[model samples]
Target: MLHDIGGQAPNPRQTKIAVVGGGSTYTPELIDGFARLRDTLPIGELVLVDPAAERLELVGGLARRIFAKQGHPATVTTTSDLDAGVAGADAVLLQLRVGGQAARQQDETWPLECGCIGQETTGAGGLAKALRTVPVVLDIAERVRRASPDAWIIDFTNPVGIVTRALLQAGHRAIGLCNVAIGFQRKFAALLGVAPGDVHLDHVGLNHLTWERGVRLGGPEGENVLPKLLAEHGDTIAGDLHLPRPLLDRLGTVPSYYLRYFYAHDAVVEEMWTKPSRAAEVAAMEKQLLEMYGDPALDEKPALLAKRGGAFYSEAAVDLAAALLGSGGSPYQVVNTYNNGTLPFLADDAVIEVQAAIGARGATPLPVPQLDPLCAGLVANVTAYEQLALEAALHGGRDRVFKALLAHPLIGQYAYAESLTDQLIAHNQEHLAWA
Candidate 1:
């Protein structure tokens, strides 16, 4: 069904892909992937769509040069108009930040004042991002539907679980993606002395809240080398997560680094208060990246971009897009999609991140072994918060914001929820129309 676009199958070599936030410092990283993995996705045209004219031109120019340098024949173009850019495209990638890093700096800093972890995709800060992002993303999806009805929207936006749910609820064709799974897969492979493709993760839970229950070699049914990985590389893996080695040994599972927020809330809050907000560091990094993009001779992604994070982003994007468009990609990948009984405990419409078969019909989550009560309870708690968050994002009101914040496990107390609600409104009033 995914291949049947307007009753005609899409030509694999004529794929057109659009990056909504084309001007972002992250664009080059994505472009680098398109160039390096051209055989995987086979993009005929790449469009960079953004409202920021200056940054769009700079990123667009670098993108073309990168393709040229790689000897890939894809035509790279830039445009400020959204509809024009996505028209007839086979896939559209959403990476826009509604309020940019200045707003992200506010999202990361304000919540710490309430004794909660300040993060762009979790806690009160995440709620702020979801509220601003969901509406804009829905509007863009609507336009994409009108312009290219069969175009698949590959959302790499933060608060992915929430945004993808919004698109699906509105009846749009979409899939949510993140680099965390691929990043872990690569790290585990290196530790086991194997290829990244040879590694398969029994990765489950909501986006940003997943745990790797099993790390299989060769395929999903292949030997689960997770326990071996923990035994051999416990200290190294635990160090990366910033969690205690004993915790991993006891649980016998690998939690994503984001879990540190929930697993060690107060300690993380204390550390966040001491360090510069991640958003601030990224904003400074973006300034430098933009200046580097102005360089005409730089045809490849800079080593400095590695420090910008989103590790393995391009590979993940290309894989998801290729699979969804009926091109040859990995048979299985970790993606965010409808729960649809994947976790029977949650509503069928709830969006969840898990390992699934990726193909033209979109993601089909592999059967999960029974989840531990410890992780299941946390996943359920966050799912409830996400549902409330979506309600508030779709229909804004101060009360709705307060309800979502209060529902979050990190801010269950009414007093803290009230404070965060007021702070979030004050900081993001410009973007929230109801405010």
Candidate 2:
């Protein structure tokens, strides 16, 4: 049985929601959703929690203005106190970055030194992020558990699979969320010239590493039009993924762009060598965004925030929160939840991202057709790396870190793993208690 937090159901008209990293530039996007979709999840109170008091104040001010402009009745408040912010929240969203973009810059750059893709959420860099992030998230989750025992924890942190597994292993009432699925739903909907809600994706695999095997119209049982999408708009999709159209044609499924780091590792490494790390770009963007937020006249999410990434984040968060709170939302949405035999090859306790029926009880993955060996092989490999990553995150030791890095498909060479492990520890020593 799923663990029950045991409380009276939340009053839909008076729901209290807390965002742990609420001072984020991403908060405006989320606030935009709460204001626009108020009827779906009527929040009586919304709390923005962050240790950065200055950013909290700026973001909180904007949040209130946005809500007022939208004529939403919800009260918006800001706090640096985690416990106080989450005290009575019906749902708490996690989007904190443990070491900020500086650490991320390190995560991105150091892996490239060893000729590997240096992304914040994949390869050796991802293991580094997992190490820095998992412990912090678990600590925050524990605080929420104590302050709001019935509060549902929605994790949007990077390296989501590893962090989420740590949460479940510790018995926190948590579910992982990402924007990839919803992004696809919107993209495909536009291509099909239908309402976004009318499109349902047969999205399956682990977080970040997923593929859309089928695109159903009207509903899950609706006719699959994936082939139609490929035939007509294959070039657009391939260009977006930075991969060739023939590859998608050969696979007959749409792989997440993250796959490029794996499918074209050396190519991506070469590309990274020429471009600034994504962290640098985001850091610069954030500076500009915070300045924009301080403008009293700016009451909406900036167009620049769109380029800051996390596309469709607000909608996905609102939908997942509503469904988990027993409020109204789409019956089928994609989320990261316990495998529970969803994929036969993975451990039941493993976390996988797939289209699921989300309700107050939590996410139940829909039955997935057998995965083609091409995708399954990679998924299984990454799942193993994720398992090892969680173990290292939960405990702290150089050996564990090295093993996780070695297990990752993107950095399988023992020499690279060993070098990356040392660099990871050197860069993240302050965050890792045992480093």
Q: Return the clash pairs for model 1, or none.
A: none
Q: For residues 57-174, could you state the per-residue lDDT of candidate 2 as single tens digits?
A: 8888888888878888777777888888899889999998989989999989988889988989999888889998998999999999999999899999988888888998899999
Alpha carbon lDDT of residue 435, candidate 2?
74
Candidate 1 residues 1-435, lDDT tens each? Answer: 011101223354589998999999999999999999988889877888999989988888888778878888777778888989899999999998999998999989989888998999999999999999999999999999999999999999989999999999999999999999999999999999988999999999999999999999999899999999999999999999999999999999999999999999999999998998888899999999999999999888999899999989999999999999988889999999999998999999999999999988889999999898999999999999999999999999999999999999999999999999999999999999999
Clashes of each: 0, 0
The TM-scores, one per candidate, come to 0.97, 0.97
lDDT of each: 0.92, 0.89
